[model samples]
Target: MTDGEIPVICSGKGCRAPARWRLVWNNPRIHTPDREKVWTACDEHREPLAHHLAVRSFLRRVEALD
Candidate 1:
């Protein structure tokens, strides 16, 4: 880790593992139809996290971390 280098963290509850993926989402009821929200996930939590959002129709897509 270095100054100004923020670590990627998993979005899963209570998890601190490094993130390897990005979950793109938006709460249509709360945000504009084109607005996007982002959540980071680790390899272990990616599926569960993505599913959680997907079930709510909040997930748009998942992509590898930049």
Candidate 2:
């Protein structure tokens, strides 16, 4: 978020938009209960990306990109 710093980008395939949200998740089958992973999303890809994770029950929380 500073000058010369690279912006975070959405995780959506082939989409190169800057991220505005954070998707927190983990695969229970391969991770400990307290473990967490993250995916970033632009406003446009947020919903679809969240939906993909929700369907698999991998999504933990969504937060604004800091």
Candidate 3:
């Protein structure tokens, strides 16, 4: 995969699409805030994923993953 390519399909349950976004996130209770990695998401699922992560304050950033 390229630097910004989605290595897998969208992680959202019951959905499958070539991911278009990389959501860098970590849970402070289990990992340091600085400890983060990318999660692939399709456009339709982007907001839901982001909202889920944001509600728990686990989101670091969202970026295009080509």
Candidate 4:
């Protein structure tokens, strides 16, 4: 293990790549307006993952990690 090594990986299905972004969202049907759900994504999976949530109107923000 290293100092900057995060244990979490991308949320993309079957993808084991390290996460480089944080997808923040809320499913209004199941959660309160302020309740947030997060999904991690690597560079490659970021767009598709975000798009999937956004089309459903669930994506709130995409935060790039250092």
Instruction: Please tell me which predicted candidate would have the highest lDDT against the true structure.
Output: 2
Estimate the overall C-alpha local distance difference test score of candidate 4.
Answer: 0.94
Q: Cα deviation of 8 in candidate 3 (Å)? A: 2.7
The estimated TM-scores of all candidates read 0.90, 0.95, 0.81, 0.88
lDDT of 2 by residue, 12-55 (tens): 99989999999999999999999999999999999999999999
lDDT of 4 by residue, 17-57 (tens): 98999999999999999899999999999999999999999
Off by over 4 Å in 4: 1-6
lDDT of 3: 0.86
Q: Which residue pairs overlap in candidate 3's backbone?
A: none
Q: Report how far residue 32 has shifted in candidate 3, in Å.
A: 2.4
lDDT (C-alpha) at residue 43 in model 1: 97
Overall lDDT per candidate, in order of appearance:
0.94, 0.96, 0.86, 0.94
By TM-score, rank the candidates, best first. 2, 1, 4, 3
Report the number of the highest-TM-score candidate: 2
lDDT per residue (tens digit) for residues 1-66 in model 3: 769864679989988788889998999899866788677799999999999999998889999975
The lowest-lDDT stretch of 10 consecutive residues in candidate 4 is 1-10
